[model samples]
Target chain A: MDPDPTIAAIARWSGIAPPNEAARIGLADNAALITEIEAMRGTMGFEEEPSDFKAALRDCREPTP
Target chain B: MNAPVAVTDLASLSMTEAADAFATGEVAATALVEACLARIDAHDAVVNSVIRLDREAALEAAAAADAARAAGRPLGKLAGVPMMHKDMYYRAGRVSSCGSKIRRDFIPGVTATVLERLDAAGAIDMGTLNMAEFAQNPTGHNAHFGHCHNPWDPAYCTGGSSSGSGAGVAARFFYAALGSDTGGSIRLPATLCGVTGLKGTQTRVSRAGVMPLSFSCDNVGPLVRTARDAARFMAVTAGHDPRDPTSAREPVPDYEAALTGDIRGLRIAVCETFFLDGADAPVVAAFEAALDALRARGAVVTRISASSMRAINAYTAMVSRVEGAAIHANWMREHPGDYAIHLSARLFGGYAFPAHLYVEALSRRGPLLRQFVAEALTGHDIVATPTLKTRVPTLAETDIDADPANWSRFMAVSANTRPFNYLGLPTISIPCGFDDRGLPIGLQLAGRPFAEATVLKAADAFQRETGWHCKAPAL
Candidate 1:
């Protein structure tokens, strides 16, 4: 039988060697990470700006008593 | 004036206390270095926390410090204090393996900005401490270097990728050690080892010349024996660094001076949703005790809800995974076997993330932070949680490569910590109590962005009311 297509596609696209069975199992378990990412897909508006590298400093000066 | 304390007693002094002794000329710097070296020699065999010990150079530096003090020259706040750092921080003409075989002999010409800051503050660099490979893992099981055993108990984990920082501090081998937190590395080890760790608001400290894990989440901080020590360490190391453009340019506060021990009207919110979900019973008991301690110090504690945190915690990994994979793209392609199996597995999945998803994760950071702040911290000064939802696991339990079935246990170590990294807020972890197994549990206090002073002040107040931070591991 052929290898799992999901694993094969990941191997081919990444150009890294195919992970061994243990590694493959761990990778397969990242479904929750993917699900979270998918849920936030369009939650952001275009008007909303991404965080800047200097955002920390800006937020620091955000005026708190 | 009284006579100088003995070198044997130096191990018992906190970093702030030791530095004060140094400033008063009560003890020679040479004695401090020798005492720490002796402790490392006697205890490090079991802890496996140190990667390198620059004995000769450290002693020489100590002598120089003594001479400078005798000459009546100005001294740095950390003058004569001995410390080792996580192996990932690069120093010129020194080996920084970063707990990875691939970089065994890698030496960078420039020292990390944080190292330069510590050097300027008169801190002695004894050597490098152990960490997870590429600062990747949270439970401190480095396949390249032997796992860092907890000083409290050799069988349990030291918590990583700042494993050595935690263990070495608990062992009293050094006053403080720098631990980088991408997702709870510093805080986890601090909690597990019964020390204190502070992860300032993201970019509060420069990351120039340090190893990168996730560009967005990486933070530089210290794991020390007391919140006061962490406060002083942050004051010295925080602020803008031209060397690191991402470093915040905010004026550094006198973190040590901020510890007034009065937290009157300090409102701390406890979210009963995601943070406390499935938390271990013992951990819950310890966290409530910590709240009581804080309340005794005039801090108002209330329960609140931040429903968005569940999604926040879940999405935190995507940013780090994608960025870490990109950082190691070349190495992953060429020397895949050089990495530990579990680390390789985690990085492998990073390659599977879609570009838009990576961008989405990054772009949504601001909105999510705003949402979380509005939900959790609108009427509160800080949010409190258990640093780890569960007790510290054994090295055997978290060694995923040894048995992949342990993945959930391994992943759980950072569940409470990762969300703060995502929110880019200043957070701290301090020992609260021990679990049924006698492993240390940590209380986490997170503040509004760049409100590190508030975080440290509250922590110091709690420390004043409780002796948990004063309890040393029976190494």
Candidate 2:
């Protein structure tokens, strides 16, 4: 089986997030993070992402145990 | 008569030698323990490596071991060896400051699994060692407790966040000690202190009850006088733990058996791109010499294909930052001024790690870890590289507030070591040589997932042949 959605998404993003961020926020805010994620997706070529990846983010953002 | 009874001399006295002498009624554990306590009294004033010296308990433990042997009870290999634990690890009812005022009086009822394992193995618990506050900073300086000076050169850094483990082990106050690495804490200090450090594969050793740094990256391992000593420690401390899900369920190997030092046909790869670049002349020279030494000792060494190191470094940055930030997020928000200024931005910054980036960095480690385990080390038993890339810098030089060049170089030099933590692989750093300043430099050998035996074999062989790891800084 393939890796979990959130993990795979992280893998995708791990390739793209530029090291130039002044801070993590700056890193996230800079188009660099998204750009890298998108680029990695293009390289391996994932057309659609798992819905759970987005849901996991919502849970992490909310932190509801 | 006894070389002034230095800690270095004591540590240089092998655990095997000491244990044998003690068993044969030649030397008493009480005598060795007293020697360490006396040395701590004399040189610790200069090193400041030990934060809390538990004399009463240490003597009691020593006396008990002597009693056990006298009673004809077969003792463990590390019987009567004196050691310390980094303050980040909880000692029942003792305050584990994590080097910050935030938890100054915070004590735990339970002890760390590694410490429990050490106790079971028959090591004398000398006391708690110093560290970078909250295991956040890699440099040894602590804003709250005070800086732990390098034993080789008091002015130079001992490296952190395992500052005291490195220094205490180096100075001989203890034969071996425990250090945790989130992002190169154990290896950095091991290299800087000129000792043997094993950052056992993540989850290879239990992490239950230790202070958290980065949950994903953090691991408990030995910082010792030699890899053999480290292996002795690993043999006892390793095993599946019901308390920590991350702890491996695999059976612990015969670390002593792995130490025969015969790597005749072992496939060992030397990483060129990230490890070899941007290193100082002295470090580069020592590393090349180490490669030569290993080759002469009969092992294959070749450069493996490396991806963009920046990508790996970037991943380490986010994963550690986000997780570390998460750990301290509460304490930091509660008391901002309580933390070292250098760690402040890094921890709080984890929250700012766009939710996507944090998850992305966390997720990214999966494939790479599996692939490296499956392919890169397919034929290779172990991989070799410089543990660190620069000569040891001074604590005064790395104040983050004081020297940007020193801080950046400090961060960059660790590029060789941190990826293993990111990949959750076992890595060992063995002292390779000394620079002109007399500080120790280390060479890192990383092994496949759960292949700690190979890592131990390579390190133990290199150490036995070179004797670099046995050399101690005159305190």
Best by TM-score: 1
In terms of DockQ, the best-performing candidate is 1
Which regions of candidate 1 are displaced past 4 Å? A35-57, A60-62, B1-8
Q: What value of lDDT does candidate 2 attain over all alpha carbons?
A: 0.74
How far residue B52's Cα lies from its native spot in candidate 2, in Å, is 0.3
lDDT of each residue in B1-475, candidate 2, tens digit only: 0112334444457555555556666666887798788778888888888988999989998999888888989877678878888997887888888877788888898898888878777888888888988887777888888899999989998889999999888887877888999889999999998888899877788899899888888889989877777777888898899989867676788887878788777778876766777788998899888888888789888778656344555566668877876666556545766666666644544554566656666655655554555545656778788887778877776775454334454455456777878777789998999998888899998876667777888887887678797686787
Task: Considering the two chains of model 1, state its CAPRI-style docking category.
Answer: acceptable
Q: What fraction of the true Cα-Cα contacts (under 8 Å, chains A to B) does candidate 1 also have?
A: 0.35
- Spell out the clash pairs found in candidate 1: none
Query: What's model 1's lDDT at B206?
Result: 97
lDDT of 1 by residue, B308-357 (tens): 77657756877888899999888988998888988988888788777776
> Model 1: what TM-score?
0.96
lDDT of 1: 0.87
> Which model scores highest in lDDT?
1
List iRMS for all predictions: 2.9, 13.0
